[model samples]
Target: MIEFSNISKSYGSVQAVEHINLKVEKGELFGLIGPDGAGKTTLIRMLTTLLLADEGNVLFSGKDVVKDYLYVRNNVGYMPGTFSLYQDLSVEENLNFFATAFGTTVKANYHLIEPIYVQLEPFKKRRAGALSGGMKQKLALCCALIHKPEILVLDEPTTGVDAVSRKEFWEMLQGLKAEGLTIFVSTPYMDEATMCDRIALIQDGHILDTDTPTGIVAKFNYTLLALTGKYKQETIELLRSMEQVKNAFPFGDSIHITLRNGYSVKEIEGLLQKNSVAYEKLEPAKPVIEDCFMDLMTSH
Candidate 1:
């Protein structure tokens, strides 16, 4: 239920976001996947009416974000990357405060946040500053949902949390989606991109591609090879120097290599063997979203 049409934002001589356009359907869980300094937060701010775009318009539920800022603010709930809750305020107090600000009470919308709030109930008396990363996240989410807004906009909600907490948060998001709340989440994690209904991979203030995770992977035209051996760094360097190589990137314990035009997998293996690389494990792999993302970034 959100639309950004050719939106552009700038500060001084640098442009944070440029000519951006996107649409989030009602009840859809949309994701913006990008690394740091990729204009994700800048875009979110513009969409939430916290920051104005220099060009184009942001509309929420058919209302102009700039002209109906108050209406948008009342309809959308935003959770910033960092915890913005009052450090001294207890979890429950913070929740109550936000509920009151939105002309409601925590109890009034308790059912909406029950799934997330039950996890934070034990820490209700603890100061927000004293809560763990995951607890703080749940508390912030509770506050965001306290008003039962139609749309939820979260920016890097799992950045610093542990893996378990991150998984739990995603599960909670899935639960919220089942309730028909439109969610727009931004994350640096490529794996999380698969969790969304559709994602836009962004870099350098530009959108590289926007599609379903499986669709993006399927669009990778090049054959991929995963190579691992005794010498990892040397293998990477050798692959980069090879004329047959189109792209080579280290992914975890293996190096992923793509062949150039007119090159074949057998030729690549022959070349590696001729160089005495002592490679053991070598196999073709289906392209993943991260691989697509890396290729897109390298090509650009």
Candidate 2:
């Protein structure tokens, strides 16, 4: 339902996004996965008609976004990365305001937001700023859906929310997707990439890879190993120093390492023992999205 063709944007000398060619099919939940400052917001703004690109074109349902911005705005529901609702207004008032601005009423499209608004009904009279992070997210989403747009575009909707709230938000999105709404969401969380039907890993204003989560992980060409040791920093440094190790980086409480050709886990174990590295575990590990992303980032 959305397409970006050779899209490029910049702010002064720093490029926000460059030559980005992407497509989001109708009714598909597509994710743009990357870290902060990876240009996800810039691309979303251009797609939502809030910002213009420096070069190339964006199309919504085959209509040029630049030439038919009004249609794009009317059909696309956008929830910005930051909470952009009025802090002083009551939840009901805020929802009504956005609904009226879109030439609609809350009553007219209550069905579209009922599932989410039901959770916010008790606090409908409260000021928006007083709501918890999760509640504020629900309110913003309600406003975004108040107009009953065809496509929902969320920019880092779970950035600062708690883990449970984040999980709830994704569940709500799944419910929305089941309603056949085309969802294009961006997130910095690597684990969230697995929740999407497909994802594009982006960095440094470029797309590293675009595929299903499994497909992306399958692209990892090296044998990976995970080890937990008392000397976490020393273990990582030691692995990086070895010729048989391609790369080593700390992941959570363990260090994830990729081995070079002909290098075996036994060899690594022998080295750790030889160096008197007090490691409790050393075993082959499955490659994850982050690993694939890191590999792609390094290779690119």
Candidate 3:
């Protein structure tokens, strides 16, 4: 439903996005996974017709986003990365305002947002600014869905939401997908990448890889040795110094090490024992999205 053909964007001397080319199929939940300043919002703005690309084309349903901006704008529901609603307006008023702006009434699309709106109904009288983060999140989502656009573009929607709210938000997205809404969501959270149908791992304004979560993990060609110990940093430095270790980085409470020479597991354990690094655990593990992401970033 969306396509970017060699798209690039820049701000003065710095490039925000670089030659991005990707497609989003109908009813597909696609993720733009990256950290802050990774150019996700820049790309989203082009897709939403809010910003023009420095080069190339952004097409939505075969319509050029620049020359045919009205169609793109009218067909998309965009929730930006930041909270931008009127702080003084009550939740219900904010929803009504957006719905009216789209030439529709909230009542007309009540079925579309009922699941999410029901949660915000209790806080209907509360001013948007006075609502908690999670409540504000729900309210924003309701307003976005009030018009029932063909595509939904969420830019880091769960950035500051609590764990429970984050989980709720993803659940709502899944429900929306089942209703046949094409969603283009971005997030800096690595764990959320697995929740989407497919994801593009972006960094430094470059797309490292785009694939299903499992496919990305399968692309990891090295053996991952997850090591946890009291001396975590020391173990990582030692592993990095070893000629056999190609990449060594800390992940969570464990240090993930990749081997260059395909040495035996016994050999690794022997080396650690000889060095007396005092590790609590060292073992091979299946590759995850974060591991694949780090591997891609480091290699790039």
TM-score of every model versus the real structure: 0.96, 0.96, 0.96
Model 3: residue 236 alpha-carbon error in angstroms: 2.3
Q: Report how far residue 4 has shifted in candidate 1, in Å.
A: 1.1
Candidate 2's residue-wise lDDT over 73-184, tens digit each?
Answer: 9888999999999999999999999999999999999999999999999999999999999999999999999998888999999999999999999999999999999999
Tens-digit lDDT string for candidate 3 (105-166): 99899999999988888889889999999888888888888888999999999999999999
The alpha-carbon lDDT assigned to residue 187 of candidate 3 equals 99
Residue 110, model 2: lDDT of 98
- Quote the RMSD, in angstroms, for model 1: 1.4
Give the Å shift of residue 292 in candidate 1: 0.6
Write down the lDDT of every candidate, Cα atoms only.
Answer: 0.90, 0.92, 0.90
Q: Give candidate 2 regions above 4 Å deviation.
A: none
Model 1: residues with Cα > 4 Å off, grouped in runs: none
- Backbone-clash count (model 1): 0
> Model 3 shows how many backbone clashes?
0
Over 4 Å off, model 3: none
Model 3 weakest 10-residue run by lDDT: 259-268
